[model samples]
Target: MKIDTLQHTSHRTNLAQNIARVILGGFLVMAGTSHLSWSRAEFLAQVPSWLPIDADLVVILSGVVEIILGLSLLFFTSRRRQVGWVVAAFFVLIFPGNISQYMNGIDAFGLDTDRARAIRLVFQPVLVLLALWSTGAWQAWRKQQSGD
Candidate 1:
């Protein structure tokens, strides 16, 4: 009975994770599309001005990357764990943009106030957690830690 219950719970968890993964992938694709087209300038507001690279190019490249990562999350089941790690790392890498947005007080994406921009910074870690959890990466890490 315990084993059966465990199996049932595991199945439900997978189902939930799969749903989250799909939703997150869709979001990434949409955001990536925006970066390439209508929302390009808005994204520029997040770029750190002190960076030497052109903001436009950075936005374009990161947009392309977002699209690719989104697709991977959707289709790369065999490598979902690695993709999760990559996606989480990507979120970490872009955290500076969120920080820059808050520090510079550049209004974009309707983040018009310091409080709003500061609030937005909190979501980056959530994205990282979502990527890891939705991909079962967190489970795998736990297993590794337990030497199972």
Candidate 2:
């Protein structure tokens, strides 16, 4: 009876975590799409001048990648490992843009305050968590630990 109670609790927790992941993944996907549309110029302008690629192309390409990551998070279980890798890669790739924004003091969507900029820098890790949660990697790790 106690074992059954623990199992039920675990199942409920997993379901809740999965729901949170879906919501977070959906928000990220939508946010990325909105960035592609409403803020393309502003985001492009944030691109560091030193970066060789034209800002316009960079914005479009980044938008495409975000969309891909977002969709992968939402679906595609067969490629779960691949998706996890891609999300991690995407997080790494876009971090420079975050840095560029801080260094250049670039403003987008009217986020110009220093406090806001600091918050921006601090937000990257949350993206990885969201990605991992969406991929169920966090749950897998927890389960593996429990088995051991």
Candidate 3:
């Protein structure tokens, strides 16, 4: 009876994760699309001005990366753990842009107010957590580390 209950709970948890993963993937794809087209200008606001790299070029390349990552999340079930890590790393990589926006008071994405930018900064970790959680990467890594 305990085993059955455990199995059922696991199934439900897996289902929830799968759904969250798919939703995240879809969001990424949409965000990537916007980065390339409709929202291109808005994204430029996030690029750190001090960075030597061309802002437009950075945005374009990042958009491509986002699209690829999103597709990977949608189709790379076999390598979900690795994909999750990559996604989490990507979030980390772009965190500086969020920081820059706040520091420079660059108003984009309706984050004009300092309060808004500060609030946005707080969500970066949440995205990292979501990527790891939705992919089961955090749990898998923990389990492997524990040698369980």
- Top of the candidates by lDDT: 3
Clashes of 2: 0
Instruction: Compute each candidate's TM-score over C-alphas.
Output: 0.90, 0.76, 0.90
For candidate 3, write residues 105-140 as lDDT tens digits.
999999989999999999999999999899888877
For residues 13-103, write the lDDT of model 2, one tens digit per residue. 2566567656765765876786679877787867788899888888888777777777776676545544665786788788888888887
Higher-lDDT candidate of 2 and 3: 3
The residue pairs in collision within model 2 are none
State residue 30's C-alpha deviation in candidate 3, in Å.
Answer: 0.7
Write the number of the candidate with greater lDDT, choosing between 1 and 3: 3
lDDT of 1 by residue, 1-148 (tens): 2332211223223788999999998889889999999999999888898889999999999999999999998998777777888999999999999999999898999999999998999988999999999987777766655655
State the lDDT at 136 in candidate 3. 81
RMSD (Å) of each candidate, 1 decimal:
5.6, 6.4, 5.8
In angstroms, the error of model 3 at 57 is 0.6
Query: Where does the lowest 10-residue lDDT sum fall in candidate 3?
Result: 4-13
